[model samples]
Structures are given as C-alpha cells and as structure tokens.
Target: MKDKRDFRLEIASIESAGDYVRDILKQYKCTDRDMVRAQLFTEETMVYWTETANEGDILQINVRKRFKTISLSLSYRGAQSNPLAISDEEEDETEFSFIGQNILIGLSTVTYSYENGYNVITFTLKEKGTNPVILIIFALAAAIICGLIVNRFAPSLGPGLSASILIPLSKAFFGLLNAIVIPFLFLSVIASIFNMENIAQMKRIFRILFSWFLGLTAMSAVIAVLAGMIYFPLQNGASTGVNEVNIWTQIAKMLFDIIPSNIFQSFLDGNTLQTIFLAVITGITMLVYKGRFPVISKVVSESNLIFSTMLDAICSLMPWVIFICIFDMLLSGDGRVLLSSIAVVVLICICFLLIVLLCLLSVALIEKQNPLQYIKTIGPVLLIALSTASSSATFAPHSMIASNKQGIRDYLANFSIPVGALFAKPFVVPVLLLMTLFVGNFYSLTFTAADVVSMVLLCVILSVAVPPVQGMGIFLFTIIFKRFTIPLEGLAMAASLFMLFDYLMTTGNVFSINISMLHTEQRLREKDKRVIVYNNQKC
Candidate 1:
C-alpha cells in the first residue's frame, strides 16, 4: 500500500473524489470510522467547491497515511474560501455548514489556506494509541499465563528471574515516577490554583462553585472511607510497626506539617502537605499581583506543561510496567494478592456508581429535574468519557449536552465544566480511599481515626492535582503510597488494575461535574431571587 496517493477530478465529479479517497484509505487499513470521515470530508469539499468554483475547475485530492496520522488534502484552483465557513445569507446552508464544520472538527483537524493560486483544505486525524484499557487487559492476561507457566515448570527460575529482571524494571519505573512526583505535584497544584484564580470575573460564581466543588469532594471522601470500612473489613489487630498515639496528637501533627519551615527540605523530602501549602501561598500571591508577576505566571504554567508532558511520556510505558509488576507478583505465587486487586477494582466501581447516583438524586431533589431523563440526555457523552477515558475528548459533547439539553446557562456550563475537568475529581476520592484500604490490608497496616482524616484530606487535595490525563492516575498512587507509608509493592498491583478504575473514574468525574454545574446554577438562581426581593422591599 502506498503511503500517499493523489486523485484529480472535475468539480462536478465529487463522487469520484470520494470513491478515490475511500479506496486509498482502505489500502492504508484505516478503520471504517476513518473511512467514513474521509468520505464525508471529500463530499463536503465538493459541495463547497461546487458552490464557489468554476464548473470545469480541477479538484486535486491527496490522501496520505504517515506514521499513525492520516492526512487528506483537497486543492482546487479558486479564490480563498473556507469550506467550513458558515454564511448567514443562506439560512439552511448556514445551518448545514455549521453542523458539518463541527463534525469535521470533532473527527479531525481542519485547516484552510491559499497556496500558490490554489485554495487548499486539509484534514488530519492522528490514529489514537491502543486503548489503555485493552492494552492493560492483555498485559494482565499475559502476565498471569506466563507467571503460572514459570511457577509450574521451573520454580527455581522464579526468584532469580524476578531479582535479576523484574525488580530492577519495577524500580526503574518507580524511579521515573518519583522523579516527577515533586515537580508535577507542586506545579500542577499551583497551576490549578493559579488558573482558578485567573478567572477573576467569575469571582461571585467562583465562590459558590468552588465551595460546591470542595464540599462535594469532601462528601465523596466520607462516602469512600465509610464504604471501604464497611464493605472491606480488615483482620483484627493485623497492624504491625505503627505506633499507638493519641488521636488529638496525630491530628495536631498533621496540621502542623502543612506549614513547611524549610521549603527546600520539604521538596527534597517529598512532603506533599508542605509542598501543597507552598503552592497555595504562591498561587495566591501570583493571583493577587498577576500583572506584576506575569513572568512568574508564565514560568509556572510552562514548567507545569513540561512536567506534565514528562509524566504522560512515563505513563505511556504503563502497559510494560503492568506486565512486569503483575508478572513479578505471580512469579512469587502471590495469586491471592492478584485476587485482592480484582476485588478492589470491583469495590471502586461500586463506589463510583454510588457517587453518581447520589449526585443525580440530589439534582433531582434540589433542582426538580428528572434524573432518568437527564441520564438519557447525557448518556452518549458518558459513554464517550468511559470509552476514551479522556475528559478532553468528552468536553465538547458534555458541554453541548449541558447547555442545549440540560438547560444550564451557557457561560456557567462552559466555565464550570472546564474547571471541573481540571480540578474537580469527586470520583477520585473513592478510588484513592478504597485502594488505600486495600494496600493497608495487604500490608497488615492499620490507620487510626486521625490517619483516616488525614488520608481523606490529602486525597481531596491530591485529587485536585490529578492531571486530566488518561492512565496517568496510577502515578498519583506513587505519591499516595509514599505519604502514608504503604508498601510500594501495592502500587504495582494497583497499576495493573487501574485501567478498570480509570474508566469508572472518568465517567463518574464527568457525571459529577455536570451535576455541579446544575447545582451551581440552581443556587445562583436562588440568590438572584433573593436579591430581587430585597431590592423590591427597599424600593
């Protein structure tokens, strides 16, 4: 199959252009969806050219599939014209063009330019990486099969192989995680806070929305802790190596730790609380004097992007890490531990469902809306979130649903959804809490009430810092485990099972965010009504 192909046809012969492009895409083994998109682009270009081009004008179509990206270019000899532009002169055509433009933008990158007496419209779609869910599933299956084979046929090789290969690989992965933990954590928190503060005009709505975000997250944390303790009870007095301390004393120590006396030492020590504190104060200062510290703001934002990119690159190696870690666990005959991880995944799923249901119920009671109908309206978007495990992919559809179907104010919907996407991760608390308990049980470690309090608080804060990157959630477990003294071994098992939790997390996160928008709108309406009544009385 050729990587590039070109077709030349008259403006009138649009169907031929579509056929040629479709055939070329087929040769490249593009998915049916991609073929459909390509065909649509060809048809759209033809329609646009037919309207604006000379009848005998030649349309040049170039279809190229290069290195996981598919590019389609349609060049026609004409004045500069954007095929996607919607003109209001023709109302019906405008509507059609508007919808067509959104469809093209959703499926691919669309650009228009004049190139040497020809108007060129190009569409490019990057083939997405193998779904992390599918890859991790395959990795788990392969690890189990290979581990059983080694254990049964050559038990003597297990320890030597694990020590020689597996442990080192596992350590290397964690080392990468540890390397980014401090900077990623600090910069992401600062970025989140700084971005939140950057929205100064929305300060009024921000107060209400911010409160709702934290309040709902805190509620989720409580639900997570209670659900974990109730559903998964640990053995009696199974804890080892933890000291008995007064609950008040533990609480005081946790509070005092948040204020770092030495920020440098805190960063070196990986003190999450102190670092978070530093980020908060710094973010607030930047927000207060944003004009004076423009350079500082840019540096924080750029540094965050750099570390986030690094973290994402590290996460791309997760399938291999999952395979190595799970294989290591099975080689040592820790089949029971593997089973425990599956149970934790199930628990996390249930917790997410509970959170979503509770949120919908609240929306129903407070907003006087139909929960079932709301779900039906947003069901497609939720499915998109689940399948992609990406908030970025779901944002457009979700925002459309919020504004068009859910009747949320456009400004509120747009603002709240993006904010929620970045910082409001209500679903993450459950996964963190439940996984913390699983690791604690696996290691026979116990937490006092104070420890649980600290865990919940930290989870809520860390949840804010959890980057909206698919499969990147597992790396946060590196920080979480280190903070509470949980064994790092649990991280490997959690990484293997994170794919399942991630799907649920993203879906629930999307759902909870929509609910927050609805609730925020409702509260604002009530506030407006109260203001109206007060004004009337004054008059």
Candidate 2:
C-alpha cells in the first residue's frame, strides 16, 4: 500500500546520460522496495528553470521520481557549458523558423551559426519564386508566348522582329556551346581512353561501346523507318525536285572541309564538331605513341591536365549555358513554331524513354537483378538529370550511388559513365533523325536510299562528336541533316521538345550502362575468385 517514490535528474551531455541514469537508480537499491520511478531531463528541456535561476538563487530542486544515480549541472548565460533544454514554446518557434527559412532558401543553402550566446541562421530566398534555372524557364515561356501572340496578332512585324531577337540570342548560345564542346570532348575522350590502360581494357570498353552504338543505331533506324512509313514524308506531296545531293559526295566534301583548309578559319567559323574530331585524333595519337616520344608524352599529359581544368571551368557554366540557350530559343520566337509540332516531339520522346526503360528492364532481368532496386539506386541522380538535363552534371552523384550504394566498382562507373555521357543519346539521335525524315517528307523532299544511309551515318558521327548535354545532339543533328534539305528550323523545333525528355533517357542510358558494366565485372571477379580457391585447394 506504500506510495511509489519518484526521482528527478539532469544530464550534462546526451553522451553521459546512461551513466547518470544508472547512478540515480542505485539510490533505490534496497530490498523490498515498494516502488521506484526515475525521469531524466536535459537542459534543452529545462529552459524555464535556467532562465529563472538568478546569479545567486538556489535552483529549485524537484524530485518527482527516485533513481540510483543522477547528474545535474547549471550555468549562467554565455559560458562554455553543457547542453541545455528549451521550453516547448521556444523550441517550436526556433525549430519552425529554421524549417521555414530552409524551405525558402532550399536545403542546399541552409546553414547554421552559433556565436556570442546566440544562434544565427541565414537563408537565401528566390525573388518572386524564381531561381536562376526557374528564371530561365519563365523567360523562355514568356518569349515563346510573346512570339506566338505577335505572330498571330501582327504577322507583318512578327517574323522580322522574332528573327532579330532570336538570332543574337542563338548566336550567343551557340558561342557558349561552341566554347565548351571542344574542350569537354577533348578531356572526356582522352580521360576515358586513359582510364582504359591497356588494349584488353580498351577492347572491353569498345565492346560495350559497340553494343550501345549498335543498339542506338538499330533503334534510330527503326524509328526512322517507322516515321518514314507512317508519315510517308517523301511521298506526301509534289516533289520539290531538290536534287538529292549524292550522299557520298556530301560526305566527301564534309571530310575535306573538316581538315580545316585553314585551322583558324575553322575556329572563326565555329566548326565545333570538326574541332572535336581533330582534338580526338591528336589525343589518341599522343596516347598511342607516348612511349616513343617522351617530350610529346609530357606535352600531351600537361595539355590533358590544362584541358581538363578548362573543361571543368566550362562545365561549371553548363547550367547557365543551358539556361541561356533555352532563354534565347524561347525569346527568338522559335518556341512558337514548336507549339505546332511540340505534341509530336513530346509523344516521340515519351515513346523513346519507354523503349529505353524496357531495354534497361531487360538488362536487369537477364542479369537476375532487381529492376526496381536498380531504378531506386539511380533515382536521385535521374531526378537531378531530369531537372538539369545534363548527364555530366549527374556524373558525381551517379558515380557515388553506383559505387557506394549499388556496389558497382568505382573504376567501372567512373569510366563507363563518362564514356556513356559522350555517346549515349539514345533518344536524341533516334528522335531527331526521325523528325528530320518526317520534315523532308512534309516538304516533299525525296529522301533516297542514299539519303537514308546519309542520315544514319550522320547520326553515328554526331553521336560521337556532340558533347552529351541536353540539346547538343539535336544541334548537331540540325547541322548535319540541314545539308539534306531537311529544314533546320524544324529540327530546332523538335530539339526544344527533345530537351525536355533528354534527361530521362540519358539517365536511363547511364543506368543501363553502369549496371551492365557492374554485372559484367562482378561475374569476372567471381570467376577469378573461384579459380583461385580451386587452385589453392589443389595445392
């Protein structure tokens, strides 16, 4: 019938809570104890007592429970002391404000500060709910809307004004893109090659590369064929009598032109794809003969480092470059034309993404891995990729997840992702090429068998040359296909929509390639380990 005894205690540190709780409980270590209860508290929850306890006031003690051990500490304001508790009200205000500011600034910018007995936190708020990327998106949307409105309302003024506005923006975007492409390609390709040290490694790398190349080519061929069949682009209307330039002749001219009758002319002319070709050849030759010429080897090594630094600097500007590109594309009134074909491009992109996903699932199931687990492992990177639409930007996170989470080897992820970033435009090549064929048909431009081969070959070439960014593939597509009487403007229109889905399929490509490489490597390692175990057993 004895009433239960209670004790109250305080702890100096969360880390020492166990010892303090134990000592307090030892006090009630008596035979036939009726009942005992203990409650522990930290200063974090005891703000009122600390606040009210004056310089000399004995801190009021409360014993609501009894325990064998207890610890307590109290200090006046502004001293190095133990953790303290704040009342629910104070905690609520502070915690909620912290969370609110975090929401405003975004988690990436939220940071904490503690100084002079005061906790300070700061957050950066986007103006009018617009960050840089969002601002670009809005500007692009507005530009497109204005272009359309002006075109519909005042046709006479629209095209001229739109062209004037868009041309400059396009030029600037083109310049930025041009500046980045050569250096990026140079570093990415050379680094990828160097990452593969020997011929055996290169062989494996090429096997995967060839597989992807063939897969993309086959998919693009199918899409081009389907588009040709469905749209019957060439048979749609009266022949424009566009003498389908001999594909071979055009390719010969292209090859000749890329030799840069004058290198300076090529630079001034913004021949980026040509520049990439020249750079790759230079790098590969240097790599292949590094042993023969020490001087050339050293020069190449230093150049690679310099180029890598420059490439990094340029890449840091990619998000902004993409913004500028999107903005200019919108501002120039090109987006208005897109409205007509946007649905078609969007449908095509969705279908392409679905196809890539199906292919990824097939790879997963064949390898006896969980498809959903693979998807989840790459989910965050995929989201970032979708938002930013840059595969290289997704590289760090993708590599981390593949290596740390998915158990893929770091070397394989690092090597394969960059290489895949270079060549894996699964959707871009297929969709843009198909759209080009469709445009040709719409214009009644005869696309001969030669033209078809030309398109595929161009896609393959550009797939190799273009930096694997959001719209780079499409731009290259426009440059190449425009030679065949396909409207460059239509290709640009298709690109605008293609950019929206580029991230999804690019992520898919990275995921697929990484998983394939991982499983392949895992199987090889497992086989080697088994071999070693058997040899050891025989000994």
Candidate 3:
C-alpha cells in the first residue's frame, strides 16, 4: 500500500504519451495486475518540473520490476538539497516517462520570466557603400542638361511669359544679393579697420595688401600677355573702314566721363565705380571724425546698420534672382548660338581655369601650404561658385571656411574676402583686356604706347572699382569703353562665356587672398621685431 497526495497532471497529447508508456511497459513485461500497485502521473507534474527547473535541477526515478508485481516512485532533487519523496500512488508512469524522455532527448522547454528590466531588440547588419565619384558625375551631367534645355526650349515660350517668370525671380535673387551685401561690406570694412588700427598694425596690413596686389598684378600681367599673344587681333582680318570718331578724341571723352559730373547721378545710373569712391570717402570721413563728433559717428554707425539690414533683406531674394537671370538669359535664345560655339567657350573656360589654378598654386607655394589641402578646405564654396557663377553669393561660405577651418581671424577673413571679392577681378580684367587688345588690333588700329598703358590702367582701376554685383562691372565697362569703339555689343557676346569662368576665378581669388592674409598674419606674429619691408618704392 502507498500514500496518495493531492496533485493533478494535465496532458495535451495523452495518446502519444500513452503509446510511449505502453511500449516501455511491454519491454518491462508489466501487465495490469503488475502495474496495479504503480502510481499514475499527469502532464501537469511534467510541466511543473520543466517550468521550475534550473540548470542544476535534477529528477529522481525509481523503477521496481518483478515477474508478477511492479512499482515506481518519482522525486525531485536540487544540487544543494536533499531529494523530496513522493508516494507510490503519486508516481505516474506516463508523466515520468514523458519528462524523462524529453530530458534524455535534449528537448528544451522555454519559460519566460520578466523581472524589473527593459528588453531591447538589436539588429546586426553590414556596412553601406558611398560613391562620391558617381554622384559628382551625375551632378555635372544634370547641370549641363539643365543649361541646354533652358537655353534651347525657353525662348520659344515667348518674352512676356519669360518676363513674368524672370522679373519676380530676379527680384528675389537680387533681394538676397542686396540683403547680405551691406552687412558683409560693413562688417568686413570695420573688421579690417579694427585690425589695422595702430601704426604697427597698419604696417603689417599694408605689407600684406602690397604683397597681394603684387601677386594679383603679376597674374593679370601674365594672363593678359599670354591671352593677347595667343588670340592676336591680327589673326582676324583688319578693317580699313573710316571711323566715325577719331581714336584720340574718343579716348579723351572717356577720360573726362570717368570723373562723374554729379555723384548722385552716378549712383542713380548704377555707376559702381562712382559709388565705390563715394563709399570709401564716407568710410574715411567716419573714421577720421569718429571720436571728435560722436553724434555724426553714431549716425554713420546707424547708417551702416541700416544698410546691412536692408542688404540682408535684399539678398534673401538672390537665389530667385539668379534663377530668373539664368532663365531669362536662356529663354532669350542667345545661349543657343553660344552653345553652337561650344568650342570657343570651352577653350576660353579651360584657359581661364588653368590660369586660376596656376595662380592658386603660386599662392599656396608662397605660403608653404599644401595646395590640395587648401583646395579641399575651400572646395564647397568653390563648388557653390561654380554652380551659381556669383562670387557675391559664395562670399558667406568662403568667409566661414577661411575663419573657422583655416584658422584665419574672423576680422581678417570678413574684410579680406569681401574686399577681395570687389578688387580681385581675375577673369574680368584679363578677359576684358585681352578682348579689347584683340579687337583694337583686328581693326588695324595701332595703339600708341600711351594708349596701351591707358588700357592697362583702365583695367586695373575698373577691376578695383567694380562692386561684387552682377552686371555692374559689365555695364560700367560698356559705358567707359563705348567711345573707344570697343563694341559694347561684344559685352553681350562675352557675358555668357564670362559666367562660366567667373566661378573658377572668383574661387581662386578668395582662396589666394585667405592664404595670403594668413601667411601675412603668421609672419607678423612670428617676427614681431621686423618692420614691414617694401621692395618696390611705390606705396
């Protein structure tokens, strides 16, 4: 006889367990009479043991085999504890056999237990690849397609529609151009002035400025000479046709006309040179009387602020204006002919980019910096300029890189970049000079030594005078050289070509100026004892 305990066993597949039990019973030769004293086990016991079992939990089974009588007992034991006993009636063959077989077969029973914790799902994957080379190629192709499509198809759409589109867009771009111009100029000039406040500072400033001017002049001279030599006006047949006006007389008129009759009228007429002169005078006056007339100085400061704010508001429209300008230019169908003349355009752009690269290398060498590193540092701004074709638009990014990454002082970058934007006419001066010389020679018009000097002088002067604004320089050049029979219409012809090259040249100029200024500053900081030495006697 065996004691019975209150327990229950639940089996989901009782038939399978029963079949397994019968086979084991047969092997043991146990009949109903022999198993009559044996205990029956339920599925609940098997589940409970498996669910509560830890890695070291163990099961103890007792089997009694006899010819006419059989008995079995089951119990559980932990590694550190004594085994718990079970009654003979509580020992069930089906439950014990099922669980024991699963343990032997290495079947796993998973029981989820959550304590105070969070479950986080993690995924492991492979790294992704980036193809910058392919991206750049695609971008270039897209730009070309855009240019071609706009140039070829926009004109057929008509002017009234084009104007409606372009005017607002141009105004928006022009607004953006306008907005930043004043603040950029004001901050830049003030920063420059502050940097060069003392005599020592001024000496260093002038030294750097002189070196920059010298380098620029050298580059301009080299390009001018090379371009002039390559595209000699004589290559085109000379015209002996009588002129409407004498060359000397025309030159005289140009000289007089440059000195504006009324300053206000100059601004109204968008005379950039005149406006620059006036602005410089005003800036100087403000500086001279800053402390003595505080009220006036305050007014000047406020005016600068006002101008900056206005300019910022205006510049907000720049992208729109640029789009419109591009759209209108393309829509006019002028670019169609220009596209057909792709060889000339490409040749000119390649030559210009070459010159620009050469000049940049020169600056990098002079500064003892890695040229490629410098190029990479300024790469983004250069790309922007390449796409936008406007140095004015690129100035913000250029200044930022110059100041932050290149370790140039904000004051120096702000001042040098904007002033450089205005004065560094790398493409404009060289191309205009080359074209003028070429045209003058083509007409068999023999220029005097004085006339040649005058042309160079004009190029230098206008280059400095032109503000960093689109169409401003071109318009000024046309007005100034109209009397010289330089064919103002040629400006229109060159404008398309100029847009492509301007990006490279402007980027080059900005980069060169930043490096030059950095070098100058470092030299000054390192050699605190040396006064600035000038090789040329010129101021």
Best by TM-score: 1
Error of 2 at 202 (Å): 5.7
What TM-score against the true fold does each predicted structure earn?
Answer: 0.75, 0.53, 0.44
- lDDT tens digits, residues 1-539, model 2? 11122113233332243334334334434211111111122223233334443343232222223122111222233332222212334443353232222221122222222357533222111111123344345545665565456667776775465467645655555455456545555544554443233323345445754575556556655665555445443422233444345657755665676666665665555564566566667657755664466465444444544554444343334344444444444444444434446545655665566666666676576666777776777788878767655455565677788779877655556555655655555555566666666556544566655556556666666665544432354446445554564544344344444555465656555655565556556665776799999999999
Candidate 2 local lDDT, residue 154: 73
Prediction 2 TM-score vs. true: 0.53
Global lDDT of each model? 0.73, 0.48, 0.46
Which model, 2 or 3, shows the larger TM-score? 2
lDDT-wise, the better of 2 and 3 is 2
User: Clashes in each model (backbone N, CA, C under 3 Å)?
Assistant: 0, 22, 25
Error of 1 at 64 (Å): 17
Candidate 3 per-residue C-alpha lDDT over 16-47 given as tens digits, one digit per residue, 9 for 90 to 100 = 43344344445565533222212223233345
- lDDT score at residue 401, model 3, on the 0-100 scale: 86
Model 3 weakest 10-residue run by lDDT: 118-127
Report the CA-based lDDT of candidate 1 relative to the real structure: 0.73
Q: Assess candidate 1 and give its TM-score to the true structure.
A: 0.75
Predicted structure 3: clash tally: 25
